[model samples]
Target: MRIKTLLVALAALVVSSFAVAADYYVDITNRTGYTIYYMYVSPGKSKSWEEDVLGNDVLMNGDTQRVTLTGYTNPYFDIRLVDEDEDSYTFWNVDVSTQDIVVTLDHLD
Candidate 1:
C-alpha cells in the first residue's frame, strides 16, 4: 500500500514539473533624449520584424515599459527601438529567457 502511494506521488511531481512555465518579460528603458516612438520584438532568427509591440505608445526618456511575452519560450530575440527622428536600432541575438533585460536606448547622435 505504501509503495503504491509513493509511486502516485512521484507521478504527480513529474506532471507538475512539466506544467511549470516561467513567465517571460522585457523592460525597455529609454535613456536617450529623443522620444522612442516605436518598439519591435521578434525572434532572433526570424526574417520579418513582426508588429510594433509598443502599439500606439511612446517610450520617453527615463521611462520604463514592462511587457510580458506570452506563447513563446524562445531563448533569443531581436529588439528594435525607433526614435522620434525615425532612426531605428536593431539589437540582435539577445537571449530573452536568460537576460535581465533593461535595454537602454542611450544615444542616437
Candidate 2:
C-alpha cells in the first residue's frame, strides 16, 4: 500500500512538471506590404539574432504563423522582428497568461 502511494505521488509530480511546460501559439500578422525578413523569440536578450530565430521562419504581410516554445512562463513573452537592420522591432515584455496573443507588424516604409 505504501509503495502504491509513493508511485502515485511520483506520477503526479511528473505530470505537473509537463503541464508547466505547456505549449503556446502566437499569431504573427504583418500589416506591412513588405515581407518581414525574420521572426525570433527567446528567453532574454541575445547577441546572435540568428540563433534565436524560432524555426528560421519569416512572416509575410497578412500572414499568420504558429511556433512552439518549451518552458514558457507567465507575464512575459520575448519576441522580435527584423527587416534589413534599418527596420527592426522588439516586444520585450508580453503577457502570455491569456489564451491568445496577436502580434501586428506595421509598415516601416
| Residue pairs of candidate 2 with colliding backbone atoms | none
lDDT of 2 by residue, 1-109 (tens): 9999999999999988873555655665666555677777665444544344534566666776665655655535667766544476666655444533344444232
Provide backbone clash counts, one per model: 0, 0
Identify the candidate with maximal lDDT.
1
lDDT of 2 at 28: 59
In model 1, which regions exceed 4 Å deviation?
A: 1-22, 100-109
Candidate number achieving the greatest TM-score relative to the actual structure: 1
> What are the lDDT figures for the candidates, one per model?
0.77, 0.59
lDDT of 1 by residue, 9-98 (tens): 999999877744456777778777778898888878899888988898898878988867776756577888888889876678887666
Error of 2 at 67 (Å): 1.9
lDDT computed for candidate 1: 0.77
lDDT of 2 at 57: 61
